[model samples]
Target: MPNWGEWAALAGGVPVTEERDPARDAARIEQLDPAYHHHDPSVPERIWDWIGEQLDKALGSVGVPASGISTVLLFVLVLVVLAGLLWWRLGAPRRAAGRAVALFGSGGPAGADEHRAAAAGHAAAGRWTEAVREQLRALIRGLEERTLLDVRPGRTADEAAAEAGRVLPEHAEALRRAARTFDDVVYGEHTADAGAYQALLDLDRAVTASRPTLAGSTS
Candidate 1:
């Protein structure tokens, strides 16, 4: 092999150089303008598109068109929303009625007056839970005494509220709330205060004072 300087001398003495053009580089950079670049879709748009794509795939599997699937889905969604609203508005009475059937056992108060006296005694001692229980009992017994509620075995507080609500429409809300309070204290193991006891007492008094409405009337 020839030596390094001898090889260079043997060949034409050519100096290597790198050629750069600022104008050409600038033109290349301008061609890559961010303003003209395509942007990824927004998060919500992407999600909606993904959902539509999935729906299309699913519908296509069943030989359904995407447009028809959209219409059907919209209808079903509207129906579900309306059903939820209706349930929110009208489900209370039915739930209260169901809860009532499970509130108490076979034995109940002998008389409304006796229960009232017991409730008063409990209130005097500041035993609000007992007071609430006895007052609710008084209300139930009072209804039974006046033949407002049938003498059914294993009556529950919620049941009594429902039955009395039928008889006394004006106190229906109060009756329902009072029954819930009683259940909270007894079954739910919640502590009752004076306010709870007073509410039940007021409900009892209202039920006793109100005259029963005609049968099968729920206003």
Candidate 2:
């Protein structure tokens, strides 16, 4: 096997001279033309080329295309403007309306609890008509909250009933009967008894049990 120096010399194309003189060799190297024979730094040329290639690949990987980025930014801006306009104009009323519609049919107030309270208040005041009216209103409001009807104060029980049957097939019968009973007590001059009150309570229970509970429901 050849020694390291022999191998290195052979690899480097160094001549195998009979006499090895360090100073002479140094002098001979120095005598060579500086313009034609230049010394390169130890770093390989392929290292620099590889670094540049890797940089290009890294940039391609890290950054999205300009066109794609522009399109995404435009879409975001449109959504922001639309949402801002809607909030400014309607003040979340449409969302509330939708939620109320989901909760009762019109999405007016929160739940049957509110109706029960209103009815109780009316009953305590000895206003049987108002109590009955409130009870019916509770039922209607429940439907409205459930998103079954578009509840307006001026809307009649008949109209609400029809809409309930159409919009909330599940709770239509309850709404219809409650509307009728309320109308009877309020307009038809029927005296509300314990049975009427119990009926209203029963209806209230049914509504609370059946309808989905709405968050942030308002009157």
Candidate 3:
């Protein structure tokens, strides 16, 4: 009968005789560097390479020379960058205008007294648009003071007209027309005249004499 080692050898099993050498194994691993086996590029390099390949293919299809394609791409990139910057800058004024409309509707005056004074001053200067805007503000403020209309923050002229109209049904049409006039001057960029200013002034006076209706009653 064969010995265990001989039997194992005959069965094609090798005996574990050699001990693992940590330092030598590490050195061997370093010599056979795994990094060299990994042929894939880094993320940014891969992205740039992919973009270049796609660009080359596209330009080639259009019969554009590879040399000129780079210049065209650079020009397109510059245009994209400039467009982004322009949008960022010009967006501010529109946003500010929207914020102003939300905060004070057309524009803000200090108070009803200040608005009335400013309206008078504008009227004297023949700035009818400014006069009309200030007068409307004065009218809205007066209604707010009398508790005829609840104090609404960020109220537009149209909204004020509707609320005030519900309370003063007699002047509803006039109020709506006056509000439209104010909106036309402020937002529509239309010019105002003496007739428009006088109409707003008349509406302002009428609002002052108006009384609040019963709670939850349009009548």
Error (Å) of candidate 2 at residue 115 is 4.2
Per-prediction TM-score to the true structure, in the order listed = 0.51, 0.39, 0.50
Per-residue alpha-carbon lDDT of model 1 for 25-78, expressed as tens digits? 999999799765568687899998998889889989999976798897798899
Off by more than 4 A, model 3: 1-108, 216-219
The residue pairs in collision within model 3 are none
Q: Write one digit per residue (lDDT tens) for candidate 2, span 1-219.
A: 978988899999997666789999988887786754456433676686676466556555879554465465578789999999866544445334223222122443345458668778878877666666666667767767766566565566656766756644566687677666665554343577656776766766676566443445452
Error of 3 at 187 (Å): 1.9
- List residue ranges in candidate 2 displaced over 4 A: 1-115, 124-127, 211-219
Backbone clash count for every predicted candidate, in the order shown: 1, 24, 0
Record all residue pairs in model 1 with backbone atoms less than 3 Å apart, i.e. clashing.
100-159
lDDT measured at residue 71 in model 2 versus the true structure, 0 to 100? 66
State residue 196's C-alpha deviation in candidate 1, in Å: 0.9
Q: Looking at model 1, report the run of 10 residues with the lowest lDDT sum.
A: 97-106
| lDDT on C-alpha atoms for all candidate structures | 0.78, 0.63, 0.79
Q: Against the true structure, whose lDDT is highest? A: 3
**Best of the two (1, 2) by lDDT:** 1
Tens-digit lDDT string for candidate 3 (166-217): 8888888999888777776775456899988888888788778766566687
Model 3, position 50: C-alpha lDDT score:
93
